[model samples]
Target chain A: MAGYSSPQEFVEHVLEKELSKIEESESDEEILNKLKGLGYID
Target chain B: MSSAAGLLLLALMSAAGLYFDGGSGQHLAYIGPGAGFAFLGSFLTLLWAFAVSAATMLTWPVRMAWKAAKRRRSLKKARVKKLIFVGLDGYDPRTAERLMAEGRLPNLSRLAKEGSYRRLRTTFPSLSPVAWSTFATGVSPARHNIFDFLNRNLKSYLPELSSSRVNKPRRVFKIGRYHIPLSKPSVDLRRKSIPFWKILGQHEVDCTILRIPITFPPEKFNGRLLSAMCTPDLRGTQGSFSFFSTRNESVTYETGSRYPLQRSGNVVKGVLEGPDHPLVPDAGKLGVPFTIYLNGARNSATLEIGGEKYPLRVGEYTPWVPVTFKAGVAVKARGICRFLLNQTEPDVNLYVTPINIDPENPALPISHPSYYSAYLAKLLGAFATVGMAEDTWALNEGAIDEEAFLRQAWMIHEEREKMFFNALDRLREGVAACVFDASDRIQHMFYRYLEGRADGPLADTIEKMYQRMDELVGRVFRYVDEETVLFVLSDHGFGSFRRGINLNTWLLDHGYLALKDGAETAGPYFKGVDWSRTKAYTLGLAGLYLNIAGREAEGIVQPGAEAEAVKAELIEKLSGLKDPATGETAIQRVYATNRLYRGPYLEDAPDLIVGYNDGYRTSWAAAQGIVEREVFTDNPKPWSGDHSVDPVLVPGVLFSNRKIAAEDPGIEDLAPTALELFGLPTPGHMEGKSLFQAAAPA
Candidate 1:
């Protein structure tokens, strides 16, 4: 828990370090939303 | 110790392989059945400690000269020589008024009678982590970035601990079914914004902060600190106790570990679980074998654990017993637990407290100077290092009764009092603040008795808790003088949780949330969720999230106009929602996060905060990301009280031994107040005015 002097510093660390593993996979659900939110009823 | 000195000690410890106790922040895998580790580095750690002492001794004069000059300059304009803050978590103002009128809380009443008392405004969503973070940083929840206890890992749509993150060991050597970690897990604090203590530290103001929630993995500062809430136990869970029974019936308590005692001729045996095997992921948990020999009369027992023997009296708790879990050759994870002999007659029913991470040989970075926790353990005795060590859940689950819970909570309280008072005596200057959770935990478990929901022998528990806190304040009065400023406050207040409002179920019913095909209900973490069709959903206790396209990984709703429209619709429909069972309004208000907060992290905030009415809270199901079939349920659990509601309904109580102050104060204001008392200007980004300072001429 090293001290961060400010929020900007913490944010930079998060975006550049912690969140470097951004997902690239696409969801079929997102495509279904484009087709008028079709057939998602359970 | 000073910040520079603390950093030096931390470096020495890190160099000596005592860097981290395995940064398993809420990672339950490591603390499965038995695995605790330390001895592999104990000799090196000891050697480093001596070397650092010698190095510090040699460097003292020059370092002292520099620090003394900085302190003199910082204190030149100081308004007070010393500032002390006593935090009584969840101490309600309404209850205090009633008890003070009854002459039950003499010390708090005296402070109000002689000085000042005000209803302190708590943070939005009214949670300890959020409220205490604001108190520490003098900022909005968006600024501190601790809006809830659990955060949704957007990629997986699962809940993870929000306060801290412990990355897994990066480098490992695999050999014959074992993965020996070559690197320690990198532990990081997730709470944003600079705490006022860090600011004070920059000004050469030494402070001691103790048991403040959300401060796990204590950061380096120009002061001493012992982490509090969010510090997990050796089993890497929040607080999971173990129960050994001989009923031969398999019953699982949600919050406890259940093990059957092997009984043969009055000799019972059970394995005490520790952390997972450090070198082998699939090796299960490292365990310690213990034997309990029942007395001939079958009323008492003698317990043997960790190569030591102690007599266990019926319905009595044994002193903290040290246990070592062997992970590998020369590798051990040390921990301590208290055994309670519930019964020994017909069967053996023993309750073992959650194994707290050994303070003397912690498996995590729980203190600022690194060795400060061990120092305290050496000075005092082994104290509970697990966050939420009071184990309210054990009482709620009926694993332990009222008396046992009370005894355990009070024992932890005494341990805290010792450390707090020690800090006060030694802190002749700078700031010293300590938060006591007994006030919060006792009320959470016993508020039912106050509400007359369940008649119990400990009906007067809440009053007794308030009295105990008052006695504590009276003791603290002795340490305060003319040059010292004492301010006592609570993060939030308490209320009965009579009904739980499942926002997820409501969303499902309202067609805002959709499940997968053939699914009528979702398991924990939204197992059956259709993320795209789910325009609006809820997770965690205090928030409703919108599945905006760019925000969440599987989001469907478009940001801006579409998201706002969904938020507005949910707010309109949910506000003042009535509970059909109780025939009462369950929700008081709905707050749009964008309107409520303005900061860098506002986008990360929950889209809509559901401010339930005083007697209502987010259902346990909703908090765990489960979509149930029903919207409301009567909360029958022993944890009958909470503070997660409209902030206005549960303002915390504040008492100060000073004559003049603002008519109202807030958890955030205390940070600026502490800064102003030290004659330091509050940072411009801080959204608080000094409580002791009046408004400027408009």
Candidate 2:
């Protein structure tokens, strides 16, 4: 948060960090869903 | 003048003299002695040529017409309303003799005593596919090109399971060499090959062939045939029929519905009912609990799952009671669910018999190992790459449970026999050629009995299996009558093998076989091969070839000298290799490829064909194997026995109600004899002479 210039940027950075952590802890099914959300599959 | 021309001139002068003299005898004196003698010689030559031409012209067409007439006469005499050919595969005469002596197989024994029995000499390799193909084609293996189960890949020096057709080019093309057609003809048909069934069919005999092995993609014929490619394993498919009933009301179960039951709540529960579907209309009785006897059906309907259709049928019968359908109760169903409902639109409470696979003996989970012996290592190896890695030393020889395997095999044997005997009872007409494979399969797995391996797993069951087969044979004899001609045959005989030699491996060691860049893959020879030193090599089908000059692609061995030298060297080397324990010769015979293989596909056979001693056999995939020890071990697997040696001793039995002379018969003579028995003329084209006259006592 300290590295970011604006509140919005700081919020975005924190959200991205949390998302990566969540992905790491996700199961195969959850990861599949994430990939589908990214348009990897129909 | 030349002798031939002088003779021609003299004959012409004499003809002119005779013609001028009005065909009178006085013209002979008028021509003078010299002219008369010359004319006589020329006339004799002319007569000879005319006679030869006339004989050649008369032979073929007249013979063919006579044969057709004979076949017709035979059919008429016998008035063959129906003809049945029963093929009992791998039935040994020696065993039959023993069984008869023991008072077992009473019916078969009686048939043998009353009927004429003769031993059939099977085609070379004596393997099932080759022998059965010959039985179908009535031709030798050489003509049929079905020498063994596997054909040799000349380029790779590897063996592949032989097919009815060649998938790859039989020979490699070389510059400036004639493109010789080296491919073997397909075994199904040949100009000379005459199938016995085709003859019967031509005569308009209605025949039904049941369960003859290897008749897949059934041949085109007039007869109605249910090709028995094999006695198919019926455990997985839902071939059985089932039925269901409801009392007083239509309990319509929708075309597609799920019925689930839970202990908490459900409807009226009763025994699961009748055949899933009615084969015979009105086969089902109207009762509360329908009694359904599931007789196995060959083919049936399918179930729709999601957007796709699943080909699942009810395999066998399972008893189930109707349960009240509810949402909570349905959720508990692990497997597929069926519904039981009262009459509604589209028959919601209708009795539906859905076909499905038998849940109990589904397909066996056994898979042949991808790499022989290597799979055993991978399965046993427990550790990562280390010295003789833990996994490498590990052996998963199926937990080494020999007894369990034997028991399972015996159980399968019992079921197979039951099905076979039952099928025999059902068939009233048509050919019933049933094959009993238990004899062959069991022998392979349990030959250790004769090998003095006491207290083996099958010790108790082996004799029992034999006794059971004898009983089954007895059962078959009961149904057969004087009209039936039973052929109990074996493709080949079996013997004990002590050692196996990998011909490819041996060649690689001796540098006779060249490898690619230090790799074991067979590559282009003569490019990196040293032909000067290599004397002998071996390949499949016991084919041995010499490095003859002008014959090989790169012939370093001089023509005449090399052939003899190579043959002698090979014979000495192969014959010298003996089993360490037995000190007996490992190889009994090594035939030269050309000498043995006269078929067009001889080029595809091994260069040096080796016939191992009675007890030994080349491994199934010998070329791809690593020859670590000289002879690592004898066949220690489940298939300890093989029929690659001497032919099996099964003798074919022929019977007829009509009194005929007793004469010795060969397999080839069967067709001609059948024709003669029917009072038909034996076909001139047929090589087999008739046994009719001899059938009568002298």
Candidate 3:
């Protein structure tokens, strides 16, 4: 159990960890505004 | 010509529409002025958007389930939860050691003490594209098919971009005077082998790769990647800056174009050329006119482009200005550029950096998933999309001063750092990697300053850049946990390019290469060379190709034994060649492709790869096949540092958070090592070994 025996187990472990985090998706307009603020886009 | 007259005409047209044939006339009743066309276009756009959104919404659950399943299956044999690769392109091990010994780079020294650091062997040519291709694919340059940035087309003997090929759309519809492309133009990534991320993605391991060289037209896999190095500007070249001046000098710059601007009453106008119009067959390169209005009192200027005005102070760079080229109705190509007001008084000189493909509206594919670049643009605003974004050529040609060049480099570095940190924050269990080229670019432009030979104001630039990179490393260390493994490396080290050896002239002088009658020298691509009598030719950074009978168009040397004998003779004679000025050996060794490479594409490689000693490299003219008068000349350009020397002399540096068992790790080793770290077996096709353990397939 110290290391994964197959790729499937590793995926499950990663999915479990990913599921624990909060997910947020920003809209295109919002991303553009942020970029403009950062002086990367005008 | 008047609004009232237009309205009257529209009214007459509306009345005439009612007289059209029977059933068709009923449909035509809704056509008034331009409303019908606008309504139809908006309706179609809305309909398509609705359909796509509905489909995505309905399939979201199923797609999520499938991805989760795939991820679980791929990560089943995983060993590490997270892997981070921090690439400092062209970071020199010798300089790092010197600084570390002098107690200048504390963070790197601490990292070395806590974990491990060693010299990482580079590829044969030690070029960025070749070395990074090997790093990504875990193979030699022959296997990856990226020998150099420029590869000669044997048929025409013209040099072309090696990593990617962009072809115009094959099908077009001609209507009256307009030629509209009926299909999307295709961009092909020419690097042959699969990148390590694709292999990892197949195993269901998610990856976020940023700005890796030779990844232009990024390949599709289970990852997000931003392409780097070899990505062309909007004008379809590596990097070409535009210089506008009022000085009546017909000077030709090596890497940039100088245009004479006509000034009338404190106003100067110049045209900024973008990519070719995709919809027009013979429209040539589309150009947008810009005007600079000089203000002598304040020593400032106002730049007007595309109806927008920006204030420009002398010796100051304007922010990224978006430029649009109109191709046809509803067709516009966008790119971004920065302008520096070099001077404003007696001779107005303005420098415009090459217009990079706008990440928000890229004219060509610059990332995978197609939307990945757009997403990053949205996230970080607009960042550099052109490969080799630092504008070293501008600095080399004296179009921009040292301060301007350094400012541009660090600004790009800051943008890369933002994206890198964002990926790190998001990747909890997958791979996140980014390569910072500031170290490479700064070293390239400032090594002469560091060597105490050049009289420049920025002598400590290289040291400052290294310290900044160390700070970035320290920041990375703070973000990783026990489950995370970090790897910091460079593609190759750097050395001073003091002298340039024009191998073509040398070959011409030695009677190995031939020219036409009454022609003592030739221009680029051996224009005047008589190929029938020529036995050898040199093109690219370190390539020497023989005029083999079967392979070349006008080859004189026979293929089998005769070619081998010629190669042997050249190699023996060229190796250990000395510089007459200094009496120091210039070339260390000359390697035959057959002996150095063992891949199927070995035949496409250069017949001989030259390995120059430190402080020596191929001259600028020689790289383009130009035969100069002298065989050797002092390198006078600001690009005073280089790595296209003997591979042994420019070994890259590698540092890791974990102990590496391999005594001597090469750039190729990192790809296989990434797979091993994730508990996946190294594929049989890969020529590299894992640095941690023997993960060869049973």
Candidate 4:
């Protein structure tokens, strides 16, 4: 409460943490590269 | 796409993750309630939440006023005060008709008699995720981007989750052999296109969606939503169970792990595995030690783990057991699982259900507003957070029997009912949709009993399940009035899965698909297949894919002429292919996707959708991209019922309180109907028609 300048800021931070974005859509090539780098696939 | 630009973009994403305060990236199901905003103590966090809640209550009037101002004129013109959708995932119309005629499902008969019952056309594949995605978006799989449970990765010739992806954090700090994640992991819902609920919310119409398939990583909307299918367990897999047994033999299952149990007299000990260790890099799966005392005289056992004890009886499931693990410097990851003790006199065998993400303190966002799941957990107690909660794989593996699976399925059903009714009780206006899975799970495991047997322990399970669903509808009717419109629907119907058709094997025999030299059989993921010469192959339940020159990473067939020729060849020969054992045609039809759908993602659809005949489906080995020697095999697994067949033969059922005007309403129409009822025009991208008058409900 002390860190927040206003009540709205505190609420926004809480909701952002709670309902944060879970994923971003990538093209097949990009997804493959990322997965490959993670050693998920050869 | 230069290499330097690609590297820069990746670095920017890592920086963005750090800037975003990313939570639960690849290592999902780790953070728990009271752990977030971790700089503050738990008590301080509670104080913060209370302060926020107090502010919300104090400013409720202002928020409501602002919402009213933002609402469109359609809010006042909405024809219905409430719209309730009851989705029974795999409720077969044929079985429903039989039960209704036999007076076994009286409430369903009442609903049909009062309003109307129609065979709703499902999607081409007739799978839950595909059909339900259509139902939500008012579009086909091409537009919704959900064709099956697994979609093939063109680059690796491997299968990836069709609906979502979890990417690990990019930034990490290392010191003294310990690594600290600077940015949190992320989980992304991959299904493209917007659902009807979001449209309704934009128009200021509230929606409370519960457990709809393909809804994991719940989208932000105007109302509450709890995700369902594709929600991974704490271990970040769909649903992986653990079996601890005293047997010496080692065995493996695609969906679960087996651990050896060491016993001395009455005391038995085993290691229960959890998620990957968060702070330690290169460390394998995390484990927590467990001890069990077998009581042969009493035929019961006492199990202890993580500073808690649970008493387990034979053929009965222990209540959800909390299994906590050390996740970080001070953070602890929590998960819950149920244990079913098999036999003790012979050799102690225990089955622990996949450790579900704790609903109250979930590591992943299973519900929109995130706290909604925690609120429900507090209100209703612990509920299963893992998608596919019934554990059908355990039953199929013989780790648990039919009766045990039924017990677990019913428990989940009851839990869902409580939440659905709670939504109903709280709903003053707008839509409340809840989909129950037991109707699908029980039918999948017990439909074979209906095949040839007259009487058995599980012969009547499907009928009983339908009756229960009917009873659930009866309870839901209590909330309906002239101001409300009610709809009961199934994503797709069910059928027998007796004969497994290995499409890859068929392709191999016809030389459409090829194997490596001296390798007559290919292992899972098509390990022994020679992709250079292979023209076509099948991976997902949807159908077969072609190796086009410009499309696949390793392309052999040219796009314009060669691809079309290969597709035509496969379609001509594979259609009406006969099974040698039963002499019945395995394939009913083969649909070229280009003719079936037109959209931006049409290329994602399998080249050909093989419509299986009744009692035939993709074989167990073939579904995983394995190449078996034979084309047809017996489906020996207990998962004997299926809906992945010709869509026309397995049309889902839709019963409503008002008559629908459309002659053939499909699963996609429901979304357009919801939008129309709320006095909002359906989006131009949607391809479904309004089924009833907007003014009828009132």
Candidate number of the best lDDT:
1
Question: Candidate 4 lDDT, tens digit per residue, B1-698?
Answer: 45455345434533443221234432233342112211222466668989999999999999998888767566777889899999999899999999899998888888888888988999978988899999999888877778887787767777777888765665665544444455556676867678999988977888999999899889998889999987877777667789989988778765677899999999999998887666554666678899998866657999999888899898888988988766433345778999999888688888999888888777778999788988898899889987788888877877788888889999888889999999999989889999998998888888888775336877878888898899899999999999899999998898898888888888888888888996888987788899988989988785799988767778798988778888898889888889989889889989998888876567778989999998988887787788888889887778888888888789999999887776678898999899988888877778787888432342
Specify the poorest-scoring 10-residue window by lDDT in model 2 chain B.
Answer: B385-394
Better of 1 and 3 by lDDT: 1
Which rank order by DockQ, best down to worst?
Answer: 1, 4, 3, 2
Error of 1 at B2 (Å): 50
Comparison by TM-score, 1 against 2, better one: 1
CA lDDT of each candidate? 0.80, 0.39, 0.79, 0.79
Question: What does chain B score (TM) in every candidate?
Answer: 0.93, 0.53, 0.91, 0.91
The reply for model 3, stretches above 4 Å from the true place, is A1-42, B1-56, B175-177, B260-266, B279-282, B694-698
Model 1, B1-698: lDDT tens per residue? 34455445434644444533333322111322122222235677669979999999999999999999999898788989889999999999999999999999999999999888999999987989899999999999888789987777667776656787665565655555555454556667888888899989988998999999889889888788899887877766777789988888778776677888899998999998776676566677789999999888666889998788999988788888988776543455678899999988788899999888888877677898988998899998989987788877677767789999999999999999999998988988898999999999899888999889888679989989999999999999998889988999999998989888888888889898999995889987788899878987777778888888967889999998888898899889988999988788999899998898788777778999888998999988788778888999888888889888988899998898996467778888999988988889988788888998875656
Please give the TM-score for the first chain of candidate 2: 0.42
Higher-DockQ candidate of 3 and 4: 4
If the candidates were sorted by their TM-score against the true structure, best first, what order would they fall in? 1, 4, 3, 2
Q: For candidate 3, give the lDDT.
A: 0.79
Worst 10 residues of 1 chain B by lDDT: B25-34
lDDT of 2 by residue, B1-698 (tens): 45455345435544565311222323212110001111123477669979999997979798668656755654666623333344444555565566678886665556567754555555445566566655654444444455553443323323333422111123322222211112221122111234455555566443444334444324556443333321111111111112222234333321112232111121222333222111112223111222222122322223232233333223321122221111110111001112222222221122232221111211111111112112222333211100000110001122113453343334434534544454456554334445555566556556567456645545744446556665665666666665554445455445554455555456657655544456543321123334444444433334444544454444556756666666666766775466667777666666555564354334344445566776766643342233332442555554455555533222333433333353654444545654554445554434345534565455
Q: Model 3 has how many clashing residue pairs?
A: 18
Docking class of 2: incorrect
Question: Fnat for model 1?
Answer: 0.04
Each model's RMSD to truth, in Å?
7.8, 29.6, 10.9, 8.6
Q: Ten-residue segment with the worst summed lDDT in candidate 3 chain B?
A: B29-38
